[model samples]
Target: MSAKLYLYPGWLRLWHFSNAILCLILIVTGLSMQYTTQGDSMISFQLAVSLHNICGVIFVFNYVIYFIGNMVTTNGKFYWRNWGGFFKQAITQSRYYLYGNFKGESCPFQVNEEVKFNPLQKIAYVAIMYVMVPLVMLSGIAMLYPDIIIPELNGISGMFLTDLAHIISGFVISIFLLIHIYFCTFGTSATSNFKSIVSGYHD
Candidate 1:
């Protein structure tokens, strides 16, 4: 039986929903800009640039709220768990993803009030949220204000390096978002996770 838990608060849900929309817009605009050549692109280069900048700025603020919310609320605890035995737990969870899940074996780690995320999920979330997101944001800021970037970074144009970093990190986040949506389908029912995000309860 699935236990119902009020895991997502109203503010958290709003942040998540807005974050999803902004990320989609940013990713689309980013791709348009990246692929533009001689004024040919999915979206006009000028419009793509404008939308990307607008959404990027909004994402910055939204990320700040997420960081602060994690710090000041219990939500942060899930991501802040001790790393002891993490590798072992991660391996077990990985095995489930690779083998056990296909065999209809129950998950090695189940969600509860104290531990809402499995080991691999927690690690991925930490790395993506704490590390990759910040990297992307900093590189994005540098691109927006070229004047801030040093003229040369290790004999290469700083702007080039900044753009590269931004692209790579953005790509990582885009991939994560896709995988996250796929994983959300794993629940009591195919739509249960989606409904939980809307109603702020996990079943």
Candidate 2:
């Protein structure tokens, strides 16, 4: 099999990993902050809340920077462009992962600048970044200012809704994180994808 070298690009790797770690920090700290435990603590409730907030701010910074900077790259186009093909690609890739790839077949979609994602990736990346990511951020931000939001929420309980939204969004992201890591192991060397993200070069 011939190998192609398309350097993953440094900024993309930096943003991806940094964003991931910060987000995970938020996830863990957010959970710890939410539940009031009277026992041993990974982090004190007060400290968890404070750390979560700080991590959140860092996450937001990374989020905005990446969104603006990589709007033209896989970070964006992987979701926005050739949307019809996205659905088709998703179906085919799904089949490959479920059955065909086990038989050692080549990937259904080619990887190139013009056609980057294999359907599954477009939907996953898009949903995570565009849909779910914003939802979590919004609800988390709202939770940060329940008093302010409560007044505006009027009649409806903002705390209940915001907490629900935050929990649901966090669940989705947690699942995405799990799946992301699993798929990363399915690459050529069982670590090619991880290496790609780290070194910005998939070999």
TM-score of each: 0.96, 0.90
Cand. 2 Cα-lDDT: 0.79
Candidate 1 ranges with C-alpha deviation above 4 Å: none
RMSD of each: 1.1, 2.1
Worst 10 residues of 2 by lDDT: 145-154
List lDDT for all candidates, in order. Answer: 0.92, 0.79
Q: What is the lDDT of residue 42 in candidate 1?
A: 72
Tens digits of per-residue lDDT for model 1, 24-85: 99999998888887855778999999999999999999999999999999999999876789
Candidate 2 TM-score versus the reference: 0.90
Model 1 Cα shift for residue 34 (angstroms) = 0.6
Most accurate candidate by lDDT? 1
